[model samples]
Target chain A: MDIQKVTVAGGGVLGSQIALQSAYKGFDVTIWLRSEGSIERAKPKLERLRGIYKSTLEALKTDPSAWCRGLTDSADVPAEKIDELIARVDAAADSIKLTCSYDEAFGEADLVIEAIAEVLSEKEAFYAEACPHMAERAIVCTNSSTLLPSAIVGYTDRPGKFLALHFANNIWKNNTAEVMGQPATSASAYQAVVAFARAIGMIPLELKKEQPGYLLNSMLVPFLNAAEALLANDVADVETIDKAWMLGTGAPLGPFRILDIVGLSTAYNIVAASPDAANPDTTAGKIAAKLKSYIDAGKTGVNAGEGFYKYR
Target chain B: MDIQKVTVAGGGVLGSQIALQSAYKGFDVTIWLRSEGSIERAKPKLERLRGIYKSTLEALKTDPSAWCRGLTDSADVPAEKIDELIARVDAAADSIKLTCSYDEAFGEADLVIEAIAEVLSEKEAFYAEACPHMAERAIVCTNSSTLLPSAIVGYTDRPGKFLALHFANNIWKNNTAEVMGQPATSASAYQAVVAFARAIGMIPLELKKEQPGYLLNSMLVPFLNAAEALLANDVADVETIDKAWMLGTGAPLGPFRILDIVGLSTAYNIVAASPDAANPDTTAGKIAAKLKSYIDAGKTGVNAGEGFYKYR
Candidate 1:
């Protein structure tokens, strides 16, 4: 179990954070972001994140550079640079080998974590590509919030070794994670994944049964929808609607406030498009549609300075 | 403006707190408990509340006994106490009169507040009984969570004086109130109510139009329903669910936790039976029915030591 080198797929907020944190943990990490153009666009962000990581590590009184030593920006390196990236991943291999790759980067990974797009089809395609190249026992995990674990690995040959490892935002700091078990996910795999999550400073909330959207989102959606309804009903206006939850419930921000931060459009889509919304009362369908109307009208909430309420 | 005496009705939690606070505010207060039986049952509670009120006044650097010198307990006085209650109330007339009555109590009241049961029919019946007896200039307000203002006072002769005056639970401390307006309610009445609520150390979040459940409950029901669903789905145990809101979302307690403290049976009934639950997506119907089963089985949450999860 001397896994060292690791590859991180995707360069979204979650993916990037995973890459930065993996580097911080003293792992030889490679981030396989989409394309050359994306690499160009993401370089500044990656650089800034690295700087932040450096400062964070320094503040914590730890060696900042140790984990990020062989950090390679493998977004769109030439076919030749792929070997260089692979060599860099393997060079520091006396330790654990961890890779963040979609099958293409699989040759060097003793452990692979797929932090790619959340779409089921895209995930399945990458899993298909990575399955043939993965080491026999290389542990695979998805940072999925909703997609069912069994469904994700249903097409994979080694479904027994795969599991859903859900992480909250700010992965480097947050402790809450859900270790979900699929029907095919073996007990050994569950224990190993749980141990790994714990080793990396996570408070793992294990799922006895795999359910889509897991725990948090399953609850969060209905609350968000109700906020939208408050707006639709012309009940208390936006400020009061937002303020009531804060003052009455002591919520950090009211539902509408959280909705704006999460992107009203995204929140609305999730609520309206959720497979669970078949029941009107359970889904907050009217509110979701109302939110969509607001989004469509270019009033996408705080991000655009207007939502349920105007923002400064 | 010389309010030397006051009558506080109901003598329940909200009613008792309001009465105690009114007494501490230097008004000679008479509390109108429902019946001789209720008075007997509430004797110890009133004594305890008096202690709490005294401490609260002392904390504010005020003399409780001096202000509460005229406090009267109308507990066992029977039907004969009504005249004494009215006389005491008239003696305390300082413009704002808080009560939980729907009967002849409003005849002498300058401002009659209905804080009785949350049921629409009960509240409406009380308002009907109060309006005809109310002074021509007297105002009527209901501390309702969901019922429409139009419906509450629609049958009353003086609907123009009726509106919704929502108060947070800790009435003596929380300065927030919501003034909801019915179509028949006059502008002057709305403004006066706002000013009155403000005079009593409340910040009014005024609503232009009245609707069932108003704004706050409209926004809150979804949150409660979401929590119930989470419990039903086994996302997290009750404690963890409670922690997510308190620690994660920074709410005082998660929805179910609040429901427990508030009485799971009470909350379940409100969500399930309220006219507001007529809207879709609440699942209040299902959850409420389930909670009722628990309650019937003597498994009522927190107070009963068992709910979605066990308490010590």
Candidate 2:
């Protein structure tokens, strides 16, 4: 049950990071895409990620505290040693194959991490196609941010082999992998994924029960929603709310600043999914309306240079 | 309306801090207590706070970043200068007088802060009796944690002058004051309170509209609730949940640690106030049940040296 050959089923943001991180950890990684267009987008993303890793490795070579705990005992490690590790990651990157054919992608995958669109039908189709070609021993895991594993577990041919292996945005630094299993999932399958998560440099938080949004988002979203409610209710303006949070909690960034980093549109999508989104009186509806105005104005988030506040 | 004389109508934990801070700011401060027993309890709390201020000043001298922002330019300023400031604080401490007589406490008072019990009846009774004795131009403010300004504004004779001016714990350092006015509160009243907050070294977050729980608690309570829910559902252990939060958000302390600092009983009282406290199905009820078990065991919080975690 040693998961070495990993197949990532999407090459978008979280998917790309997961793929790059897996390769960097010396796993024989393959990225599966629906079309050549996705592969085209993924190429530049991979290159950009490589550049980021190079700079991060360089920073780790100098200051260990630059990125929290920098690559472990980074201070004692020589520049040549860090460069060598960077070269190893590059070598691992070379071994990764981009495939459009499901059979080719799932050929030797010990683990297939489904990172496709969050849409139910889309995930079902991806799993249906993937299940037919996947190895008999290969465990499948969904990289869903919000959707439950039970929703997709039924679509997979082997329900006991399917589970959720969620990862945070920054795979390299904030290396948190939340492993959630459906009721039918085998303990062996869950353990293998947990082991794989650790192998790829992530602290695995194994949930005994299935939870929508898992641990991080379950706690974080409510906090963000509360901040948005204050704005929508007109209790205080954005600056006052942010300043109050910063001054009160001694936190450098407030919820609004975090929303800017998350991209308001993505945050809006999560809120919009709930049944309460339709009611304007509800906090979700108010948040959606505020986000819609920003999204409509082309102020989506930090990437767009503005959201709740200006980035630059 | 130049406010000079200040009468704090309570000798509780927050009231003691408020009176001490006001005196430190050179206000002619008076603490009106219900009984001599209450004054005795407040005396030790004030001494401990003075000790905290001195040690904090010393830390600022050695390490500027020890506690967010240091008091003045402590590095360049000699230890003698810090000693002089401490002596000045001690001198201000002399100005704070304890009184059992409301007439004596409120005499020549330009501002009267009602920091009495959270119970509506007690607050109303105190306000109903103190109104006739209050100065014609004096402002009345409540230091309520959860209750809205609109709820108690009607109890005062001058609704236009009544408001809520809330402060966070540890007034000397984490000096956040939330200024919330009722629907009937005058613009001048709100402005005067905001100015007063600044004069006492507090960063005032003036709310144009009344909000229950205000800014800090509005955001904090939901976070604590989420953590409690995770524990109640048995998704993960306490340490695991806390570790997940800290590692994911880079937050210094998790919700459980914060509960310990707030005192579990205080946190319990907040949850118990909700109608859901009777039901085990809801998060509020679940939190109350968990907290009650600890409370029944006489493990209140940090004050009792035990809560979610035992303190030395």
What are the interface RMSDs of all the models?
2.3, 1.3
lDDT of 1 by residue, A1-312 (tens): 555666666667776666655554566666665566655554565556655544443333333333222232212334454444334333322222223334546666655677877798898787777678778877778887767877788757688888888877766554466788788888888887777665555666677677666666666776766666666655656777777667666567888777776778788667667664555554365566677688888888787998766787
Candidates' C-alpha lDDT: 0.63, 0.84
Model 2 residue B220 CA deviation in Å = 1.3
Supply candidate 2's per-residue lDDT for A283. 76
> What C-alpha lDDT, on a 0 to 100 scale, does residue B260 get in candidate 1?
69
lDDT of 2 by residue, B119-195 (tens): 99998898888888877899999999867878887888899999999988778777889999999989998899999
CAPRI level of candidate 2:
medium
Q: Write the per-residue lDDT of candidate 1 for residues B1-312, one digit (tens) a residue.
A: 233344445666666665555544444555544567766655566566655544443433333332221232312333344344434333333333333353445556666566677687776565566566667777767766657677677756777887878877666555468898888888888888787665555667877677565556666666677777666555556665565455345466777766766677777676676664554445545565667777888777787887655787
Q: Could you tell me the TM-score of candidate 1? A: 0.76
TM-score of chain B of each: 0.68, 0.90
TM-scores of chain A, one for each prediction? 0.75, 0.91
lDDT by residue for model 2 over A16-41, one digit each (tens)? 88888889888889999999999988
